[model samples]
Target: MEMVAAAATKDAKRNGGTPEWRVTVPEGASVTVEHERCLAARAWGWLVSCVVALGAKVSGSGKRLWKIGADDPRRAVHGLKVGLALSLVSVFYYTRPLYEGVGGNAMWAIMTVVVVFEYTVGGCVYKGFNRAAATVSAGAIALGVHWVAVHAGGELEPFIRSGSVFLLASIATFSRFIPTVKARFDYGVTIFILTYSLVAVSGYRVEALLVMAQSRVCTIAIGIFMCLAVCVLVCPVWAGQELHRLTARNMDKLAGAVEACVKDYFADQPADGKQPPSDKAEGYKCVLNSKASEDSQANLARWEPAHGRFGFRHPYEQYKSVGAAMRHCAYCVEALSGCARSEIQAPHHIKQRLAGGCASVAARCALALREASSSVAAMKTSWALDLAVAEMNTAVQELQSDLRSLPSKLVEEESPAAVLDAVQLFTVTSLLIEVSTRIESVVDAVDTLASLAGFRSSDVEKDEASETETKVKQPAASDPDSYEPEKKHIEQV
Candidate 1:
């Protein structure tokens, strides 16, 4: 067997693309081939892992595709609008007269529709107007530069051209750093730089400069106007509407994550003594990721007009505070999650008492967030928000009280393990208090948002009617066996 193994190694090294692997065994009778992890075995493991990763990738992509398809059944409306706009522009160049009349620059028009077009009509409107403004302003400046360079002539012309490029590039680069301009006029800034560079380098003669600039601007404007028309006139997709919806969805995800975290903190172990991935822990990141979407959409939404009768100027100021509140909520969740993750040995009795109160408070907190999401979605502020917040405040206070009231016997134990458990419990309780405060901020922010969006008492009442039906289908909050069961136990603490 040793001779055969030696021969196998020699043959493998002679024929191999990969470096040689030689097996060595103990000089005893314990040799077993079954334990060997040879090339075939390693290859099989690599193949399995690759297959698993690919399957997950494909599955995730499919689910995302389905959502995109189902979420907007009328997406084809935007597609039709795009196609129609493109075809109309195509007809201009297709004809002899109109193409010449429009300066014979079909690429400019076609590219404008393609670049200015977006999934949302408001996005197109915002980008198109910005692009045209940038182009015109850049064109005007370029023509001026051309005039100066032409009149200067010879050696001076090259120097002047270089100076103009450097000046414009430096100024534009610096201006893009400012927050407001960066948000709304970022695309414009980029286009301005591109246009200015081209004009400076193109070396247009004095006589042809104006004509060239005019043709470029005209073609771009036609494209912009065409795109704007199609977007507004043909099944417009409003960015503001989508922004509001996205914010609500984000709130809902946060609520779900809160619920999952609370459940996992006190969840029972598997029967086999192994722990599966906790649903709540998995949800923690979802709350964090929602922040980016909220920010992007809100900025874009501000550029949009007051559509769907939500009123003008849209109180974007409120989102800034709400985001602060949401971030606070996220930090509290992280702290609480950290506590649950650490292994702290506590007496079973103490564990039971702490968990019961903690669960009650957390569950109510989750409900409050879920309600907040629903209120924002319907554009109806909840009357119960104040009450729910009060409940959380009270529950958190009582939980603290209960923690303070942990049996006197625990004090006598004086064990380091008991001390760690007590410390962990306090840490988690403090996080809950912070969570309650942040939830209040969220509730207040949403109320202000609803009011700004033109919500009234009547709107709340109308929305509540539908929500009441939804609530009735589920168990009552006051039901004894429900998740909201008898806060009475914690109340007495």
Candidate 2:
């Protein structure tokens, strides 16, 4: 068998193929062969596993992408709008007459579209305006400097050009550090620096500087027009609308968090030793993280023109105040959440005493927040909001009274362990009161926003008032006896 195996190996090697070994056992026994085929099988298995893993990864990425588009179809529309803008701008390069007009600078239009087209109309307009202004202003300055440098003689021309570039660039860079400039004009400053540096440096080697600057500015203007047209005319996403919706949504989330926290704190624990789900209790965390989004939306909203229910000078800044108030309330809600989850719980009897009052305050506050959200979303003030807020204030007063009565009860308990529980309960009650206070601030901010934005009075309020008046008059109309005295008195007068 050894000689046969050695011969087979030699034959396989001589044939320039993988070597195979053959082993012979006793005549009746089953024969088995181990060869490179096993290695090949292992390699195939590894390759299959790699392919499966790669497929899974690709599938996961595809699902996430799909989810993004599904979550907001605006993303897909924005993408199409971008494509349309780019296509329109590309006409400058594709059409012969337009190509002759801009010459070789047509690429600037394409580049401008890519850079300026944004998710929202206000954002696109903001960037487009900045780019156009920066390009033109920077070009004019660069041309003036170039003209001066050329007449200064060759020796001093380099110094003049380089010095102007350095001085202007430094000033522009420094201006970006200012809060107002950074908030409103940071992009403009950046573009100014880039355009000025490019035109100034290139001016040294390129003659006909005026024509070059003109062509670049014209192409950029063309691109800006295309972007503005596409963004505004087709499925525009208004930054003001986004800010309004976000502010309202945050209020709703805060309301849910407040109600959830109070209810969870006073809830009876399950006998199965399972913890309750905390998804609603944690809703306020989103409100806490929304400061940056609110600020960005407000800033961009300022650039938007009057559209839909918004005016030319909508109170974008007031949204920030609303966000601030919500965040304050959210912080208190977070504390309430912590108290709910704390191990040092108030005695069941004590909790029972305060539960109704706490729940009433929470429910009233939540209702007021929801009403406020509805008012903001509808761009109208509602009687419902006023009523809800008034109820919340009443509930808060009642809760305060209930809290005042708790001290005597706690003193009666007087146990050391019970003291800790009372302290925890006090912390929760204090946070609840603070949260209610902050909610009032939020409501006030929304009211201020409504007034500043010129929000109309809701028809629902008017209809209800009219209905009440009709009911009051109908009784007099139907009951002739009630109207007879007034008619006789008027006749005598």
Leading candidate by lDDT: 2
Task: Compute the lDDT of residue 485 as modeled in candidate 1.
Answer: 38
Off by over 4 Å in 2: 1-35, 270-277, 410-419, 459-493
* TM-score for all models, in order of appearance: 0.74, 0.86
Q: List the residue pairs that clash in candidate 2.
A: none
Cα lDDT for residue 445, model 1?
A: 86
Clash pairs, candidate 1, are none
Alpha-carbon RMSD of each model? 15.5, 8.4
lDDT tens string, model 2, 1-493? Answer: 6789789989899989778777667653332334456778899999999999999999999999999999999999998998998888888999999999998999999999999999998899889988988998999999999999999989998999899989999999999999999988899999999999999999999998899999999999999999999999998999999989998898888889999999998898566533364788888999999999989988998898888888887889999999998998898898898778766576767677788988999999899999999999988997889899889889889889988877776678665465556676777777888888888899999999999988888876688899999887776556778788799999999
- Candidate 1's TM-score reads 0.74
Best by TM-score: 2
Off by over 4 Å in 1: 1-68, 71-81, 153-155, 203-206, 271-281, 343-348, 407-409, 412-422, 458-493
Model 2 global lDDT (CA atoms, 0 to 1) = 0.88
What local lDDT score does residue 312 receive in model 2, on the 0 to 100 scale? 87
